[model samples]
Target: MTGSDPKADLHRYLQVARAAMLWKLDGLSEYDSRRPLTPTGTNLLGLVKHLASVELGYFGETFGRPSDEPLPWFEDDAEPDADLWATAAESREQIIDLYHRAWAHSDATVEALALDAPGRVPHWPAPRNEVTLHQILVHMIAETHRHAGHADIVRELIDGAAGLRKDNDNMAPGDQERWRNHRDRLERVAQEAGRSAAVLPS
Candidate 1:
């Protein structure tokens, strides 16, 4: 394991995050996948759409290998946060397909470039915008996992499903009744702590 190639390691982690992102949509209905679960309209499919755009921008445009795909939502006159969601016209399958294509394109960029290969982020501030393939890979891994975390919560809210991945849930061992009891205990603890603080010296 210690002899593993650095680039391969980074790419593997990026792929893991990508898989987790898509796995979140498994068995979800179109409505459940698209429905806004958060105050800011975060949804499972929206997360997929947003990450696809992120990968394209970071890996494609930054590397001077731009994608031919038309992304009107990113145009100057487009609505705010247009990339953060899909329209009714954009079917779930379509968005997921786009995401898969984006992954292929990004992977090509990764394969063609060395870790230190230079690229520039046109949208980032000057000087700071200059970056290497290594930097982009690290940045993207964090970005994808961050959104995957959001999907985890959103998916759980829509149904009772929750986990790090389909293979390993990474949750405490418990039945629903046990889980409910655990939550109740935490609530009681919180309430007790709140009262204790309220009675503390001013």
Candidate 2:
């Protein structure tokens, strides 16, 4: 396939990562979407909330295009990790809509600046606070995809549903029995290794 323009290419990949992350929340009850699947309280909707705030800061305020939206979670007196989880009143619809709006605002910042356009990250430490549009684009891409990976695992834990996306599962074709057998084999190998390590000389 032919290549897209640089900005278009970056934006396309960012959208892919965003969609992949949001797709993990599809077809789940509100409780399931907000349920903390991991010990650290990582949940599908929480991830959406986190990314929305991340984009708003990196693309909006960092670049001098502050969003009209207020993020109480980032306020001075807010609790630690406030943006990392959704509150009871924060519905899945609200978080998702915020994320989509972040996309639009972030897109505007991208459109208004060149790749080499300079900006300062006020939250960052000295000597590394300044950045360009290209840097932020790459940074957000990595951040978005990292969360998408988390969402992939969380989604699987929720209902055993696993895939890169709806149309393309991106997993090897295997029956449930075959997959179970494979997992059992891996578990046995891991246990053996653990046992062997335990018996090693100090």
Candidate 3:
């Protein structure tokens, strides 16, 4: 490999970000990680479960090498948000282990396939025909990060531990007061938008 191979560079950045996302859950108690953070039951452990399925599908099935393991849910018919919470019989450790394993297998595909390597996303509405490893990678990055956010909030609520990474390397750069003000501003904006939407003419 060259001293700074562009291919390796991109992959490394993606891998780093992916690891940071998972690391956000480190050291948390099982109950806390699996606790329903919202009324719809979006829990950290459940996100991990959903991610495992996504990675397996995008990387494995896309290549005509779908996994043989029994999917955690939606095997036949899926509830609207069945993938957003843990099943009564599923332990936190099992879900987490499966997610990590999915990462290993999915990343191996990333290494084996080229950015333009063709994949078929049978579920897409229009392009229901084809895709590529690059597009899938980007989609996965977004999905993982979205769920990692769920993990972040849940973790913080559990033990006041909040960060996008285990080492807090990706956290804010300023004082706590400034951060609070920023968050408050965001909250106010959201509230205002909600109120405005509610009051709009029918």
Highest-scoring model, TM-score: 1
- Best-to-worst order by TM-score is 1, 2, 3
What does candidate 1's lDDT look like per residue over 1-202, in tens digits?
A: 3587999999999998999999999999899999999899999998999999989999999989999878888999999999998899899999999999999999999999999999999999999999999999999999999999999999989988999988998998989999899989999999999999999999
Runs in model 2 lying further than 4 Å from the true structure: 1-4
TM-score, candidate number 2 = 0.95
Each model's TM-score, in the order given? 0.98, 0.95, 0.77
Model number with the top lDDT: 1
lDDT of 3 by residue, 42-61 (tens): 77777777888778888898
Clash counts for all predictions? 0, 0, 0
Residue 49, model 3: Cα distance from true site in angstroms: 0.8
C-alpha lDDT (0 to 100) for residue 183 of candidate 2: 91
Against the reference, the lDDT scores of all candidates come to 0.93, 0.93, 0.75
Error of 2 at 199 (Å): 3.2
Per-model root-mean-square deviation over C-alphas: 0.9, 1.5, 4.4
Clashes of 3: 0
